[model samples]
Target: MQAAEADLEADPRVAEVVAAARAADVRLVRFEYCDVSGVAHAKAIHVDQLAHKMVEGVGLTRAQMALNLLEQVVPIEGMEPVGEIRLVPDPTTFTVLPWSPGSASVLCDQLDHDRTDWGACPRSFLRRVVDRAAAMGITVQATFENEYYLGTEIDGRFEPVDAPTHAPVYSAIGHDHLDGLMLETVDALTAQGIVVEQCINEYGPGQREISVRHTDALGAADQQLKFRDTVRGVASRHGILASFAAKPYPDEIGSGAHIHFSLWGRAGEGGRSLLYDPAVPGGLSPLGRHFIAGVAEHLPALTALTVPSYNSFRRLVPSAWASSTTAWGYDNREAALRIASPFYRREEASYNIEYKVSDPSANPYLSLGALISCGLDGIQRGLEPGEPSRRDPARLSPEERERGKVRDLPSSMAEALDLLEADAVLVDALGPLLSRCYLAVRRSEHAAFAAADVDFEIRHHYYRF
Candidate 1:
C-alpha cells in the first residue's frame, strides 16, 4: 500500500482497538458523532461485529446533519432522509465508559455514499482546517475550561445539586457535597487518556470547572466532546443531571467552555511555541500578533459559530468575565480574546490566547476550526490587532474604542447569523454546504426561541446537549 493510504488507515487502528475492546469485555460499542447543535447521536454494535463496523462504519441518515436542538429537521436542500452517510469509527477516540458497563464509545467522522468526506460533517470540517494550518508550518494547541451546573430534576423543575447561593467561590461545602461525582469523573477521564489538570467549584451554585491539559487541536476538540459525555454520564450514575446549557439559570452566571490556544512550529522531539517571544512587547511574537489580529478582524462574524445558540448571547454581557467585545488585552477577562503573557516559569511556551465568548453549547470541532481559519488569515495578511489594553473595552470612550477598532459582539443570535452570512472569508473556509446547513439550523433555533417562553425554552434545550 502507498504511504498516504497507510496513513489513512492509522486513524481507525481497527486491529488494535478491537483487541482492546475485547480485553475490556466491552459487549457494545457506540459510534458517536456530534450534530450541528453540539448534540451527540450514537449507534451501537455488538462486540462480535465491532471489527467489521470499525472498517465499514455504520449508516446514518443525511438529515442527521440538519437536525436542530429541538430534534426537528430543518429543510436544507440535499440533506433529506432519502440518503445515508457512514459514521466511520475513529480508533484513537475509543474510550471504555466507566459509567456504562459492557460498553465503549468512539467518535466518528461522516463519510458520504462513495466514501468521500461528507461536506456537511462538522468533524470533517475541523480536520480540513487543521490540515490547512499544518501546510502553513503552524500547529494549533487548545483546551477548554468547561463550566457546568450539577443539578437535579425535581417535580419537573431543575435545582442545583447543592445550591450555594451565598457561598464563596470554590467553597468546600459544595465540593464535599459533590465529591463522589467529581472524583469518579476524574478517574473515568484519566482512564481514557484525558488529562484532568484541576477541578473546582465555580462562582455559581453547583457550577464546576474542570480544566484539561491542552493537546493538538484535533485531539483537543475530540477530548472536549468526550469530556462532555463523560461528565453527563457520570452525573447520571449519581442520580442527577449535568446540564451544559449556555444558561441553565437565567439569573445566574452561565456556563462557558472558554478556549485557550497557542500556535507552534516544529522543534526537536516535539514543537516550539511560535506565539511568544520575550523580546517583543507583551511578549507576543510577530506571528502571534498577526494571528490575534486575524481573530479580531473575523470575530464579529465568528460569533455566529462560537456563541451559536440564542441562550449563548445571554451570557456575553459585561462583568460576567464573558467578554462580548471583539478585542484582545493582556490578562483582560473582559475581552473576547485575552492574551496570556509573561509566564513566570515557562515563558516561551506559556503565552497563549483565551477565547472567552464561547459556551459548552457550541460544537467544539466547528468552533475550533473557525478559530484556526481566522488565525491563518491573519498570518497570511500580516494583520495587526491595533492595541492591547488591560482596561475593559466597555469602559473605553466611544472615540477611544473607535480609534482602537474595538467593537461589540452581536447582541443576539439573529444579528450574529446576519454577520456570518456576509463574511466571505469565513464562509469560504467553512465551505458552502456546511455553512448553509449550520445557518438553517441556527435560524430555525432563533425562530423557536422567539415563539417560546423562557421556562419552556430552558426545558426544551437543557439536557440533550
Candidate 2:
C-alpha cells in the first residue's frame, strides 16, 4: 500500500522465492531476526500471510528478548514478562539459504509491545549513535573485516583440524578450506545487495577473513550482524559449525573482527574522508585526530563489548593480531589503529583506522557504536590522541610504552568487565538498560569460562569462527 512497504516486500529474499516456491509447490515464507547477542532465528508464514507480516511485522514471545543473555529461545520464568515482541522486515536484508533445499530469509528489526522500538535492540543502539553523527554534519562509514575459524572433531574432542583442512599457521601454501566457503558467502551477501568487498585466507589454522564494502555506519553494523548469521546458517546446513568465538585454539593464532571507519556527511554529501589531513601533522584531519584520541582514551571500557568473553583474553596477547594495547600506528599492522596506508596522501587513498581489539563474538552494533561514541566525544572535546606510536607499542619495552602512555586492553574477560564497570562515560553512551544486561551476560560468561577446564573449543573458538 505504501512505498516503503512495497520496497520491503519486493526484497530479494521474497523475490527469489518465486522460482523455489513454485518449483517446490510451497506456500510458506519465512522471516528471521537476530536477538541482542547476534543469534539468528526464523519463523514461517503461509504465502498468503506474507503481506500482513511484511506490512505490520510478525510477533514472537517476549522471552526472545533474553536470548542474548539466557542463550535459549524460550522465555525464562521470572526473568521478565513473556509477552510479544515484533519482527519487522528489514527489506535490505534478503538472502537465499544457499545450503538449504529452497529456503530464503529476510532480516527483521525489533518492536516492543506498544509497536515502538525495543530499547535494548542492538541495531537500534547503533542507529542512535549514527543519528548523533548526523547532527554534527558528520557521517561515519564502516567496513567489517571478520577473521573467523573452522573447527573439526578430534578423537571425541573439538580441535582445529590439521592443515589441508586445518591450515597450519600462515601457510601461504595451498589450503582450499577457506577459499570455496569465502566466495560462496560473499557472493550470497552481494547478491542481496550487502556489498561484500574482499575475502582472504588468514594466518591461523582454519582461519579466514572477509570484509564488506565501506558504507554508512548503521548499515555496516547491521549488514555485519546479518552477514555473520548468513554465513553461520549456510555453514550449518552444510553440517559445518560456524563458531564466532574470538579464539578456538589455545596455542593457535587468534581471530580478529577488524573495523575500518571513514567519515562523510548525511545524505552522502561533502563526502570527505575524515582519516586524512594535509594541513594537520601526520596527515590527519583535526576531527580524525580527535576521534583517535577518544578511542584510545576509552578503549579499556569499550572492551567489555568488543572482546567480551573469558576465552577472549587468551587471544588478545601482545604478539597476536588481537591487539593487547590501546595505541595507534601509521602503517603498522601490529597496532590497534593501523594506518593501512601512510604513504598515500590522496583523500580517497588515505583511508584507514583499524579497531584491532574486536573479535567475531562481539556485537558489531555495540562495537561500532562504542567506537563512534568514543570518536565523536573526542571531536566534541577537541581531544588529540597525542602521538601515534612510531614502533609496535605492544613490543616496546614496557618502559618505552609507559612514556608513550600506551596501555593494553585487558588480560581476561574478568578484567574487561572491571574496566567496563568503571567507565561511566561509556555506560552513559550505551544506555543503562543495555549496559546492565551486557554486564550481567558477560559476568555470567566469565564465571562459566574460568570455572571450566581450559579446553580446546574455548581456546580455538577465537579463530575457528
Candidate 3:
C-alpha cells in the first residue's frame, strides 16, 4: 500500500482528479479495462472509497482476462481463477460520465501484487511499445475513424432508425435524422475531453462516422475506449442502440474503425515530422517507407490483432473499401495502407499513414501496440516497401498483382491466427504470457462461432462491440 500510495502521489494529476471527483459530487468511479476481445469490463467503487481504492486498486480475478466473447474462460495456464490482479486506475484518464449521473470512469492497467505491470495486461503492452519508440527518438500519434449504426432493437431484432426514411448517404436528410443523437453523443464526448474532429452520415441507412483528433499513442487508445462508451451511453439514453460491430447487419455494407497514425521525432528534435520529406515521392521519408514496408510485410499476422473477431472477415472482402491485399498506394482506399493526402499548407504536419485493416472490435491498446511493433521492426531493419499500387490490386491482372508483390490478406480468423502464431516478431512483441492468452481466447471464440448458427453469430456480435 505504501508503494501504491507513493506511485499515485508522484503523479501530480492524481490530486487534481480527486479534487474534480469531489467537486463534481461523483458517487461512483468505474475502473475499466478492455480485454483482448475488445469488450470493456469494469468494477465500480463508491466515492467514499475511491481515494483508498485508487491507491490499493480493485481486485480482479486473473481468469477475467481469459474470458472469451461468450463469457466462457479459455483454458490458459496461469490465468485460472486462483490468481488475483489489481486494476489500478490511470489518473490522467479520469473523467465524469456525461451521460451517467453521479458516475465517473477511468481507464486502468492491470498490476500484479507487487504493483508492477501484469505481463498479460494489454495497456501495459502498449506502454512498452511506446517506450520502445521513445528509445529510438520517435513519438507515435494516432486516431481511430470509426463508423457505427444507430438503430432500435425490437423482439431481439435490430432495425436502423432511418429504415423508414432510407436517407441517402452523406445527405443532409440523413444527418437530420440522427441530428439529436449525434449532437448529444458529441457533446458528451467533448465534456469528457475528447475532441470531435468530424461527424457525418455514412453509407448505410442508419450508420454514422465520427472521428476524434489524434493524440499520443497511449492517449489515442484511451480516447477510443472513451469514445465508444460515450456513444453507446448517449444512444441508450436516446432510446437507440449503437453497434460498432464490423458488420452490424450482414446484408449492409460493413463498418470499419480505420487506424490513422504518424511518426514524429522526440522533443529534443523539436518534434519534427519523421514521416515527411520534401524530396521523396508523396513526401514519404525513407524511414516512413520502411515503417510502411514493415506493416505490409506483417499485415496478415497483424490482422489477428487489428481485426481479431470472426465477423471482421465479412468486411475484409475485395471491393468493399475494406482492403483485402497487403498493398499501399497514394490516397487509394482499396489498398491496405493508404498514404493519406496532406492538408493544404500543412503538408509536414498532416502527413500520416492510414491502416485500413482495423475495426472497433479490436482492443485499441493491443492493435496500436502491434502496429507500432511491426513499424519499429521495419525502421530497425530498413525494410523497403515494394511498388505502390496505382489501381486497386483486386482489379489488377493476376500477373500484375504478383509482380507488384501485392498479396491477399487473410480471409478468415483461423487463417489470421495461423499467420499470427507463425510470426515470430508479433509473438515476441506480445510476450509469451499475453501471446498465449490472446491466442487461446481468440481461438475459443472462433471455434464457438464455427459450431454455432449464423443467427447466433449475428446476435452475439451485434451489440457486444
Candidate 4:
C-alpha cells in the first residue's frame, strides 16, 4: 500500500511543527538520508535557493566516505569528483526533528548530476531493486523491528536503566521507564505516515524496540533508516543517546533492524505467499521452500550483506537472538531464518520468513536486494530448503548439529567480503561499479580493526558515523 495521504494534510499535531519551522523562518528545507554505510547525514539549502538547485542537486566530495560505519573520513581519491547529487523529498516524510530545537527533517533520494538515480546511494539502490520487482508483476510487503538501547539519567550521567526484574516481552515494559519519550517518538513517527504498531523493552538492560507495521520493501527500508535518526534525535531531547552500533556493549544486545516480509504477485498476487503452505506439516509451500533454500545456501556469502561489520560478528554469538548459524525453522526464534506463524486457509497472506542475520549495520537496499536474488535463484532451480533447527541451539549436540547440516555465518567482515567476491550471482545482482566500490569500502574497514583496540561503540560505529 502507498503512504497514507491523510497524514500529509496538516493534522493539528503536525501543524505545530510546521508553524514552528515557519515562525523560525527555517530558510532552508533539508532532505536527510543515509548512504550505503549507515551514516547519519543531510543535504540542505535555503527555501528560495531550494527550487533553483532542487533539480540540479547538491554535491559532496567522495573523500567524505566513512569507515564501514564510523564517521571518520576514509582516504579516497579526493579528485574522483562524485559530483552533485539531486535531492528529492517525499512530502509524506515530513517530520520535525524531535530533538533539534526549531529544526525539521525529511527523507531524500540522491540523484546523479544529470538527475538520474545515483547507483551508489543506498536509497536509490533499493529503489532500483523495487522497480525491478515491479517489472516482474510481483510485490514485497515488509515492516521493521527496531531494536535498540535506552540510556537514562542517573546522577546526571546517561546510563542503562534498571531492568524490570521480571518477565519482559512485547509492550510490557514499554511505558514503565521510557513512556514519555517513547510516546513522543511514536507520535512524531505516526505523524510522518509511519504505522508504528507498538514499543517494547527488549531483553538486556536499557534495551528497547519499536516495531513498525508498514508495507512495501522501499517504504519499510526508508522507515527503518528514518527511525534510526528519529530515535537518536528524540533521545537527545532527554539528554540521552540512542546508539545503532551493532554491538554497542559486550553484555547487552546490539541494535538490529529485523525485517518481516511477505510476497505476492500483483492483484491476485503470487496466489498466496510461496513461503507458507498449510498443506505441509510445517506449512511452507514448495516455492517458499525454494526461497528459503536459496537463502540458506547463499547465507555464507550473504554474510557480507547481512552482518556487514567487524563488530557485527561479536553480537552474532549464540543466545543474543542473533543467529550464528544459517538454518530455517518454523516459529523457531534461534534459527537464522525464522518462519512466521501459519496462515491457514487464507489464500493471500499465509507464509512468510525473517532473515535473522541482518543488523542495522547493513546497507538495507543492497542486502535486501541480495536476499531477493538468492531466494529467487532457489525458486528457479527448484531447490528444496531444509527443515527447521528443531533442537534448542544452546543445547544442541554435535551430532544433532551435524545431522541438521547447519552452517555458521562468517565471524568477520573480511571473510564475508571474500564470500561476496566469490559469488558471481550476488556481484552481478549488486552491479559491478557498485560492487567494486562496496567491496572496496569493506576491505578498508576490515583493515582498521588491526588499527587499534577500538571501543565497542567505536568498533560498532567506526564505519558509519
Best by TM-score: 3
Q: RMSD to native for every prediction?
A: 3.1, 4.1, 1.8, 5.7
State TM-scores per candidate: 0.96, 0.86, 0.97, 0.84
> Cα lDDT for residue 431, model 2?
79
Which has the better lDDT: candidate 1, or candidate 3? 3
User: What is candidate 3's lDDT per residue for 1-465, written digit by digit as tens?
Assistant: 565456457666766777799899999999999999999999999987776678778999999999999999898998999989999998899999999999999999999999998789999999999999999999999999999988888888899888877888888888888698789999999998899999999999889999999999999999999999999999999898899899888889989999999999987769899999988878999999999999999999999999989999999999889999999999999999999999999999999999999999999999999999999999999999888888988888877777667899999999999999999999999999999999999999999999998789988998898
Task: Give the poorly placed runs of model 1, Cα more than 4 Å off.
Answer: 1-12, 164-166, 267-270
lDDT tens per residue, model 1, 1-465: 854345446554787787899899999999999888888889999988876678778999998899998989999998998889999978888999998999999999999878788798888899999989988888889998899988889899899877645457877765776688899999999988999999998888778999999999989989999999999999998898998988989899999999999988865436888988878878888998899889899999998998888888889897788987887888898888888765588887677889998889899999999988998999999998877755888898877787667988889999999999999888999898899999999999999998999987788768876
The whole-model C-alpha lDDT of candidate 4 against the native structure comes to 0.68
2 or 4, which is superior by TM-score?
A: 2
Which portions of model 4 show Cα errors greater than 4 Å? 1-27, 65-68, 71-82, 90-92, 98-102, 152-158, 163-174, 268-272, 342-350, 394-404, 454-465
- Encode model 4's per-residue lDDT on 285-398: one tens digit a residue: 777777788878898999888778777787887767778888677777878888878445653464567878878777666778778778777777888765568755666777
Which 10-residue window of candidate 2 scores lowest in summed lDDT?
Answer: 70-79
lDDT of 2 by residue, 1-465 (tens): 865457446665544444444555446556775554544567977655554466577877666656543353333442365567788866555555554545666667677767666666677778789889889988888888887766555665555433545554445542455556666777777755777666666776666767778777877876776677777766665556666777676776777788888876555576666667767665677778888888888898888778866666778777665678888877767777876665444546546687888877777788898889988888899887745778767668767786656887778778888888888778888776667667766676566656667773364343233
- Count residue pairs with overlapping backbones in model 4: 15
User: What is the TM-score (0 to 1) of candidate 2?
Assistant: 0.86
Note the Cα lDDT for every prediction shown: 0.87, 0.69, 0.92, 0.68
